[model samples]
Target: MPFYTYMLHCSDGSYYTGHTDDLEQRISQHHAGNLGGYTKSRRPVRLVWSQEFGERYEALRAERQIKGWSRAKKEALIDRRWDELSRLARSQSQFTLRQAQGERVSIVADAFEAMQSAAQTAHPREACGLLLGEGDCITAALKTRNVHPSPETHFEIDPQALIDAYRSEREGGLRVMGYFHSHPTGSPSPSETDKAMAAHDGKIWAIVADDDVMFWADDKDGFHALSYDVGSG
Candidate 1:
């Protein structure tokens, strides 16, 4: 079974982090008022972020690490705001570098369309997917949805699906470059929780909209936005 470290944005604007093997079922329990305690009183929680790991240990470790963060920090992680996470992680690091420096970055036309389609399909909740790129140019996109309700809103990308995509991309000498997701009701900017969960380096985080797309790079300043074009080379 796959393990996940997830963050929940509670009704009171508080954040909760925990680990679960079955994200969908766990979130369902929370929503049904069956999963009591902290989240129970907070009611009407929403899943703001999640990450998949290969092992239980990794998931648990990430959970523990996130559970210790402040609410703002948790939001940064959920938003994949690397610079903010790094600032919290490295309070005194002087120099910072942006990830997409001079790389040939451009959103794929197909991926943008897929994102728009997914967003419309998952209205009132978030949508997510992976973006395939070659060097810095996005080549393709795959989208998915969270069938579960709030507090347990979880999305999954099948390993086989990923493998198949990887193989197809490799055949064309492309690579699984990064990931894209929508905030639904939230701004395209990265949240504090998002920063906490962002990868350390060399990763792309794209935020999609009904009309626009934004990219961020992990830097000393916490997820600084970079210039990007959607459906353009």
Candidate 2:
């Protein structure tokens, strides 16, 4: 018999996770309040997501994993937003690493070098790209077109490039860790315009100016400087 891992959207806007051998019977019990546990009180529960597993242990493990995820991560799973799920996972990992290491960031040495080269090549015109990787390390930098009206002092990553990156990520490519941009005549820092236009979604941002590069975190409070170490990734 097949085992299943399932998640329910409770009436109180919370989620409940479980594993069962008979998926239909288990959901019926929850709906009827026959099982007197967490879901019993949160009646009118709706089955939001489920996955089949060959073994009971596999289903049980999946149940436990979902139980530990944050609400945003859970919603991502329920909605099948694979790209968002990858980004949220990386953000969570980055948060924990920041707390443990005094807010330092890591990037692959090759990624950093690539960004520098791209920026220099686009001199006088801002260079822009997407930073791709898993967890907290930036492993790749994909140069993208700067579609802003005045490319010399501004940048806008081509919308199609952004879309394709997320699609590739859903197909098991590296996660979109963050972004990189250049300021040909200014310091490697967030311009006032950059702050005004940021999504502030807790992703890393790298600013390259001349031969120097600086990293920052576009978090809820605002952009803050981050020290970094180059690694093999």
Candidate 3:
């Protein structure tokens, strides 16, 4: 079975990270205040972000790493500020230059929220959209029809939407910085098909699966995980 690494935004404005096999049930337990420990004292909690992993150890590893994050970095992730989140991730003396390739990518908070909404609305089926904003920051998410027949496992953005996006960009609207899609019942990380379809042109790919949202930078070398920051659009 799949495992999950999650973060809860507690009433005390603190973050709690954990791992589980059943995300909804686990979260419901937290909501009911029955899962004792730190969150019990914090009371009312909300899930801010989560990532799905195919392995229990992966989920555990992610939980441990997130638990070590400073409040600012966690908030950066909660806010979907990729650049700031990433810079901070590499800011620590212990961190190395291994995180270099994912430099020019980010998504505004409002945009991420929009993406989440779209993903949920199309649950059990993939949702696809365009990411738009100024420079390297994505400020908005525009949902488009998934023209593919098998949306549950595949997604194809409407061609007209792409055309319209380019046209608007040419006419001076928010540039189409990248695109986002939901995995519905899979990992947020790129799948084999995703990797195969990537154009490797330095575009940002924000994949939403379950409650977790992750950003990646696409290039010839492959997908480089990129951090995202949430911001008011």
lDDT, ranked from best to worst? 2, 3, 1
Off by over 4 Å in 3: 1-98, 101-104
Number of colliding residue pairs in each model: 23, 0, 14
- Runs off by more than 4 Å, candidate 2: 1-101
10 residues in a row with least lDDT, candidate 1: 91-100
Q: Give candidate 1 misplaced runs (Cα > 4 Å).
A: 1-104, 145-160, 163-173, 219-222, 231-233
Worst 10 residues of 2 by lDDT: 92-101
Report, for every candidate in turn, its global Cα lDDT versus the true structure: 0.65, 0.84, 0.80
Better of 2 and 3 by lDDT: 2
How close to the true structure is residue 217 of candidate 1, measured as C-alpha lDDT? 68
Q: Judging by lDDT against the true structure, name the best candidate.
A: 2
Question: Which tens-of-lDDT digit does each residue in 1-233 have in candidate 2?
Answer: 99999999887655777889999999999999999856777789999999999999898778755654666788999999999999998986785566525877777656876786677668779999999998777889999999999999899999999999999999999999899999988788899989999999998899987645778889998898786766544
| Tens digits of per-residue lDDT for model 1, 1-233 | 78998887777555666779999988888777797755676679898888899999888778655543434566667788989987765641231134345533566545655665565455556677777877777767777444334512334445566677778777885688777776666566676656776765656777654434567766555677665544333
